[model samples]
Target: MKIYTLEELQEQDVKDVIQIEIDWSMAYYGKEEIYKLSQEISKCFNLDYLIINLKGNSIGNEYLGLLAQNITKCTKIYNLELILEWNSIWNQGIQKFGAQIQKLTNLINLSLDLRINSIRKEGALYLGQAISHFSKLQNLELFLGNNFVREGAVMLLLEIRKCQDIQRLALEFNLNSIDDNDLQQFGQNILNFKNLKEFSLDLKQNYELTSMAQSKLVNQIQKCQKLTCLKFCFENIDQDEEVYQQILNSLYKIKRLTFFQLSI
Candidate 1:
């Protein structure tokens, strides 16, 4: 079997690379080398789609902030992934780097994966702020695994939804940290999303997704006209069967919705 590395990717004369996975190799290079190589690679490929997998040694917030600031020159970037764990040392770095990173204006699809923990709240906010600069963005998936609480996550959601161009959104809540009040606020924020075509959330795994929570969520979902696909996992309600049936019946008016999955 032939082992492929980033260096090997540099030699390839490909124009549009899709889902090229780079993992443990990041740890092999020093910061300077990593930075330089990333810059060279950005220049070499006329890439429209790029997927980065940071699966080994944790990528600090500072490193990601810097990479986001410098790599915006690529004209064809439509999809992006920057997944890193919560680094207490790097939390402050995200805000500082965020202002510089917002230069990526052409992105149409973006996926941000931030490890959930108390320390990541501010970093996730900074990351969301960075994404609002892309006016052309259509698909957005923000996975805030364990980083957000009610206030921080809600604020970020409200800000990101302001981008009228977005069509798809996925938000994951930290079940342990969020409660009823948080879900209510999140429900209120969802009302602001005007153009979404696909919406998904992992709300059932949390403490706040009760029958009332489901009612609030359903009420908000009814407001969006463009929504086509709905996927949500919520708490087991008292009337699970009847509620699910009612929810599906109400959504039938949406002409674009071809797939609907709701779980308790």
Candidate 2:
């Protein structure tokens, strides 16, 4: 069943749900309401697919942090999407949520949106290490934009190297404090995944942009032989189309990925 609000969720039985979407995005529920709603969701032990949207709630870690602590009972969920953008989740909160999520070892497709939060390097490392344990994960979407991940972005990429079965991957690292050296490190190991058919990398508005950095990154991306769909996002380019051609040329020369899009 698909419910859109807290009121709708209160009317249903959580125990029998296998696929549920409770999107309370942009809600203004206070602490009591949030707590009560999470308590009900924690009872969804049989849930296999869950999409809980509470973005822009401004309640910080109280949103996912509450659900993380209470929802660890669901040990067999295969697909989960936790959308909590603009919620101000910090280091401890992400670390805790990451630990709790690690318990769900059956996840195949997972989407985690923690955009515009205050996550730093240590938190990012812990979160990455936790996700790297998902040996069954095939598709992963991790959005950490507008934060201060810095070298933590590289650390996350390194940990994700363990998800060798991931076929479709989309990562948003925009406006994080990631530097040139970190990008190079991420690019170095980008081709280790052998099953990638689709990939999206968003790194817009990063600290600095240089020709050598972009070139090195694309060099590794071009080596992905099975990619039929590839997207790249970056900003502050002096010549947009020029950069696009340089990357596009590298891909077209591959003769396998005729279906590709480059977003500048």
Candidate 3:
């Protein structure tokens, strides 16, 4: 993995760069600098994979929007990852970022680590809408743990239902305000991805999910015929041994699942 700073990237002309990891976690740049860097990346037409690490950065809406706007110019990028954990990104910034994300139709694998951000329902909704536009996406990993998510969970599930080609999905929503209804909806929506082979969910610290909801979700998951691997973590959920066994039994029905992991 080659690491590049924004200054170094601006001076060189990148060509046929299949993979890039930009570490901007410690660097602070103004909007003009961000825009210039974006233009430089946009010229790398052969870039197939990109990772932007902004962890611990104080980036807000303007920086995120500028980054997204410039990154979307690379129409051939197949895999994209963004590490924005602990940033100051809010709903307005997410909205602008989402708008640019919708233009990247060639993405096959997408990973986003936005945990501890200031995202709310509106920001989550915008992200959901943007994800629905990825017609070619197959693998997705999203980490939004500790954000202010409520209705956003439902919006995300609804939009996820539109991605018919998704094969592997991992979602983390720990410490959010999601409830039984949200899980129920999410469970039902899981059936939409007929091609899904691996599924992982982390709902630890989400106190609203109860035994009843867990049972319902397990029932829905059993309907996934193509799943080969499954991992579920519900560390803080209030549930008894019987309920946990019932969920395990439900997983037993998936004959295709070669690997199964559960934590309660």
Compared with the true structure, the alpha-carbon lDDT of candidate 2 equals: 0.79
Q: Residue pairs in steric clash, candidate 2?
A: none
lDDT by candidate, in order shown: 0.64, 0.79, 0.86
Better lDDT candidate (2, 3): 3
Write down the RMSD of candidate 3 (Cα, Å). Answer: 1.6
Q: Which consecutive 10 residues in model 3 have the weakest lDDT in total? A: 26-35
Which candidate number would show the highest lDDT if scored against the true structure?
Answer: 3
- Give TM per candidate: 0.80, 0.92, 0.94
Candidate achieving higher lDDT, 1 or 3: 3
Task: Specify the poorest-scoring 10-residue window by lDDT in model 1.
Answer: 17-26
Residue 202 lDDT in model 3?
A: 91
Clashes by residue pair, model 1: 116-146, 116-147, 117-146, 117-147, 204-233, 204-234
lDDT (tens digit, per residue) of candidate 3 on 1-264: 888877777676677566788877757665576667778888888888999887776778888888898898888899999998887889999999999988999999999999998899888888989999999999999999989887797788788769899999999988888888888788878888889999999988888878778777987899998999999888865658778778878988998999988788
Of 1 and 3, the candidate ranking higher by TM-score: 3
Instruction: Write the residue-wise lDDT of candidate 1 on 86-131 in tens digits.
Output: 4332457667656865766778888766554344556657767877
